[model samples]
Structures are given as structure tokens and as C-alpha cells.
Target: MEKKMTSGKLELVAAKKFAPYGEMYKVVDFLNKTLKDKQVIFGLTKDEKGQMTLSIYET
Candidate 1:
């Protein structure tokens, strides 16, 4: 699954081949690092219902 977070909303793209596992953390970490380096605002995580959520913020 791939996701971009914006304005409290998560835009996600999932590939059937990719299984959700420890990879999820990797994705989140990657996004966080990229956003920080680019000075962009974003967030990534699973919601209370265990659903993946990506949120982007105005920078």
C-alpha cells in the first residue's frame, strides 16, 4: 500500500501484491522522513478501526 497524507485525509494506493505487515512501519517512516526533508506536512498511520490513514497538512 502507498499513501500520501494531506489535510487530515489520507490518499492511498494499494497493490494487491504487497502484504500489510512490518512494511507498514517502513512506509510510515519513509513518508515522515521525506516530508520532513522536503519541509512538507503529512502524517501516516492506522486508524482506530485498524484502517490505514494518511493525512497531509498545509505547510
Candidate 2:
């Protein structure tokens, strides 16, 4: 059987990827440092101010 997050809790987490600087690398670093045996979900989206941002969640 496949496991799912449906029975677990998801928490919103944030990481920085400043403009004209490190982007994906920063996220990777964050994940390498913080991630353990849990699960993660991520995506790219624009903010209200029209800034492209990355969203990461722990489940």
C-alpha cells in the first residue's frame, strides 16, 4: 500500500532565495539542514507584490 499525508499534519515552512542571488541552491541547503526522516512538498508561486517565491511544507 502507498502511504499518504492524509493522516498526518502539514506545517508551513519558509526559506530565503534572494533576488540576483542563490535560488534553488538555497532551498537545497535548507532542506539538507532541516530535513530528516519526514516528508516535504514544495512549489514556486508569485506573491501579492508579484515576486516569484518558493513555498515548502513539512508533512
Candidate 3:
């Protein structure tokens, strides 16, 4: 599972297929809408198939 935190909200994304860049793009877009020029923090863990536990914090 993926967990996310931002200035506006905090939520989770479910575990899924191995797509690094694509998943990150979704993360970035989510932050952009929520943060609007704020800072971002990421906590990440990955497995062999590139499945990940991703966390984001924005301030």
C-alpha cells in the first residue's frame, strides 16, 4: 500500500503493478494540486518487482 500526506489532505494508494515513473508522476500531480508551490517530502520502499510503499509529505 502507498500512503500520502499533503498540505490539504492525507490518503493512501493501494498496492499494484510495478511502474515506478508512472506512479511517481501521479504522486507529483497529486502534490501539485494540493500544495500549490509548497515543499514535498517522500518516504519510499521498493521490492524486486518495483512494487513500492510510497509516502509523501508536503509542507
Candidate 4:
């Protein structure tokens, strides 16, 4: 996900093949706090099929 500098919201785009299973809101809330306050990026790779991505920047 990328943090839009103007709106200060996360933006994610992917194909329909990418479907993540879990409580996304909880995860996003956690990430917002961490990335916004700490300025730290996080990412995870799941083989070559998909990945979880985040940015560490504030507007």
C-alpha cells in the first residue's frame, strides 16, 4: 500500500487474483499507527504469487 500524500490515506491496487484472507481493518489500523508514527516500511513476500506491501511516509 502507498500513502497518498495529499489525502493521507492508503491506496492499494492489484489484480483479482490477489485475495488476502483475514481481518483487514485490524491490520490496516495497526499499520497506520506504525507507519505514520514510526516512519517504518513493512513488507512480506509469498513466493511469486503475491505480496503484502506498505510505505513508511507521512504527508
Candidate 5:
């Protein structure tokens, strides 16, 4: 699943990936700073083990 958020002149995208903890943390941090706005979207997914993951994209 994916969640999207947008504001005037700003947009955010979030996605989830099945990756290592280090990679996931890097992605989350990047998105947090990259977006730097309340108008952010979050995308979530689950692995076969039922582990949920999140990713974010911003513009």
C-alpha cells in the first residue's frame, strides 16, 4: 500500500521495500529531510513474515 500527500507547490511520495535495517533507516532519514514538510506521504508494505516497511518520496 502507498500513501500520498501534497500541498500547494509541494508533493510527497512514500513506498515500502524489503531491505536491510540499515538501508531502511537511510531511506527514512533521507525522506524526512528531503521532504521537510508536513505534506508528506507514506507507503507501507509487509513481508511474508508480516514485517511492515515504509518508504517516502517528496517533491
Candidate 6:
């Protein structure tokens, strides 16, 4: 069985071909400053309302 994720925790997912979720260019720039990878990392997380949200970061 799969384990349940803790509240407020982030889970990483592959985002090789997809652009960042919001403001593609700006998100890339923000990530580039902290990470030096060509591929972007997508994160799955739950919001306060228990809705799933996707977040992006540079690997």
C-alpha cells in the first residue's frame, strides 16, 4: 500500500516537457537563480482546503 503524505508536505514529480505552472518565464528565472538544472521539478501538495496543487521548481 502507498503511504499517506503528511499535511503541508511536498512530493516531487517529473516535469521534463511541461513548462512551469504559472508565468512560465518568470518561474523559470526564479528557479534558475537557486538551481542550475535544465529540467524543472514539479511538486504535488495539498492546500488548506485539501485541494491538490501543482508547484514547479528547478532541479
Worst 10-residue lDDT window for candidate 2 reads: 1-10
Count of residue pairs whose backbone atoms collide, per candidate: 6, 0, 0, 0, 3, 0
Q: In model 5, where do residues sit more than 4 Å from their true spots?
A: 2-21, 41-50, 55-59
Indicate whether candidate 1 or candidate 2 has the larger TM-score.
1
Candidate 3 residues lying further than 4 Å off, grouped into runs, are 1-23, 29-33, 36-40, 43-45
Task: Write the residue-wise lDDT of candidate 3 on 1-59 in tens digits.
Answer: 45443335533333344456656757756766777665544445677887765555544
Query: How does residue 36 of candidate 3 score in lDDT?
Result: 62
Superposed by TM-score, candidate 6 places the C-alpha of residue 40 at a distance from the truth, in angstroms, of 1.1
Best by TM-score: 1
* Candidate 3: clashing residue pairs, number: 0
Per-residue C-alpha lDDT of model 1 across residues 2-59, encoded as one tens digit per residue: 4434434433333123223556667667777777765454455664666665545445
Superior candidate under lDDT, 1 versus 4: 1
Return the TM-score for each candidate structure. Answer: 0.41, 0.39, 0.28, 0.32, 0.38, 0.31
RMSD, one per candidate, in order: 6.1, 8.5, 6.7, 8.2, 5.7, 10.7
* Each prediction's whole-model lDDT (CA): 0.51, 0.56, 0.54, 0.43, 0.59, 0.45
After TM-score superposition, the amount by which residue 26's alpha carbon in candidate 1 deviates from its true location, in angstroms, is: 1.3
User: What lDDT does model 5 reach?
Assistant: 0.59
For model 4, residues 1-59, the per-residue Cα lDDT tens digits are 33344334533322122345455446656776766655543333333555434333333
Candidate 3, 37: how far from true, in Å? 5.5
Position 14, candidate 3: lDDT: 32
4 versus 5: better lDDT goes to: 5
Best by lDDT: 5
lDDT of 6 by residue, 1-59 (tens): 12333334433333233322445555545665656565555445444654544455433
